[model samples]
Target: MLTRKQHELLTFIQTRLESSGISPSFEEMKEALDLKSKSGVHRLISALEERGFIRRLANRARALEVIREPDTASPRTAPRGPAPVKPVAPAPATLREPANDVIEIPLHGRIAAGAPIEAMEGATMLPVPAALLGPGEHYALEVSGDSMIDAGILDGDMALIRRTDVARDGEIVVALVRGEEATLKYLRREKGMVRLDPANAAYDPQFYTPGEVQVQGKLAGLLRRYH
Candidate 1:
């Protein structure tokens, strides 16, 4: 038997998928379930997957498929008499193929993961899987340092960036400092100062006046190529 939260989550996912082709994000699931953190939603999803009720698609972000639904009908709704059977036809055989959608975005040279570095623009383009992106204008940047290694962003990783001028606190963003250099760090606000924090503890946070920093874009996703 499924738990109450599990049933509600499954129902919500089904409803969302029926209305829209895209699955809801982890933040949406957490909000819908009135949970404190996104970790709670992760645990619930893990439970559902273990029970074979849903499966996650490979190489896709925010992708989920509901394979089965829970049996929630009550015994009181049982029919009184036996129902008549009808002849059923067999379904036709067909081959299912995976989707291969790729989009090319501008590769805007390197951005620092350690210290602020000059952001160079280039004519090159990077082809990314469509499933990794959401609705927004996006671009790509080559990471050049190890300050954000704790956040799983390594040196030489392709950082997918969504172009946006505004971002909420605590989000990873591409911050333009003094309109010359750019760095990937956690955006935070402190006593009248804009603080850019690094994921690695070895580095200290950089603080600047609000006017010194410009919000260029937010971190959307990442693309890593294995050698």
Candidate 2:
């Protein structure tokens, strides 16, 4: 049996993971639970792990796996009045269809622009304006560097992307280069060379062959929040 707090934590983690493909960070978890210290969060996590409700990936930040979903059923309660009332019948379950006006885009962690960082997932969902969404599947990635600052995409901004394996020349795209690293840059092919062009002058453009670069997604829009 899990405590109320433990159950709430587990439910939050499971809901976040199912929505975003990424797990929430320690700070996020702490905030969600209204805890004053990260140690408190760690203790709750440890308890959940010990009970086989969740697992943590070693050495990975925000790496969490939910082995079991939290029980959503509420416990039965005794009669509060005089205990002379008749038995009450439970209401019928109703199916809820997902809202169509708004779409929940998965935030797949951060993508480096100045330098390639192995992208991480299990991030939270961002409900974006439907008009800003383009064709095909859409997802969001937090930009982590200033390489694309000249294009108005700065560090800590979210890059909305439409999933596609192909990109036109001069289109800003998320490209997987050399099957190892991924970067956000303009995709341009000229003279049989594929160039990952950065918007900022401080960084030099990276050049590769068509076989070395794979298009992951093209930029659809950008979302920034001023703190």
Candidate 3:
């Protein structure tokens, strides 16, 4: 079993790897662990490596490969032969794979996967910040009509909208109309009426009945490609 300090260091290292898509450097590990000396953290890592809990690439930065971590259960306390180590747990199928290895189409908006393309409210995918998206913050959007010409956003552009149920008026959002078809438009509610205004003049504003449109998330950011 790892000591408290070792556990904390391991957690930090693992979380850092998951967030940064890379292992923590020695100095980073030392600083995170708040150790008085780099050697102290080094000793813990070396011990873990020797025990086959992790493997490091030679002369590589943040190239740690986790082998296996001990199970949470305590030892049986009987002098049994060498205890077999536990295995790494599998990731849930529902979760998206690393964006670096796979194309994570930002859940900007939901289109009719089977029918006409409509704004998809309640994003099904998200962009993780620790990598490109913020610290524990994520965004999702439904690609709607484009109004941001100067911003380089075009129609069908995947909007990496930051997930926020609450946002300032005028922020582009993935909104649901009576929980039916979703759309992308500036969210504004006034005098018991909701307006889904498009950024492009080519598209006219959409007025909604009272409590007809619901906001899923605000446009925190956007992504697009040139023709």
lDDT of 1: 0.79
**Across residues 1-227, which tens digit of lDDT does each residue of candidate 3 receive?**
56666666656766665665567665677778888754466567666776667766444434566667654433343255333467664221232222231113336344321122455444454433222332123455434444544345566565665556676677766676787676666677877788777656666677888577777766655555567
Q: Model 1 shows how many backbone clashes?
A: 0
Q: Considering summed lDDT, which 10 consecutive residues are worst modelled in model 3?
A: 94-103
lDDT score at residue 67, model 1, on the 0-100 scale: 77
Q: What is the lDDT of residue 156 in candidate 1?
A: 95
lDDT of 2: 0.74
Rank the models by TM-score, top first.
Answer: 1, 2, 3
Point out where model 1 deviates above 4 Å: 1-96
State residue 69's C-alpha deviation in candidate 1, in Å: 27
lDDT of all predictions, in order shown?
0.79, 0.74, 0.56
Candidate achieving the largest TM-score = 1
- In the order shown, the candidates' Cα RMSDs to the true structure are 13.6, 15.0, 14.3
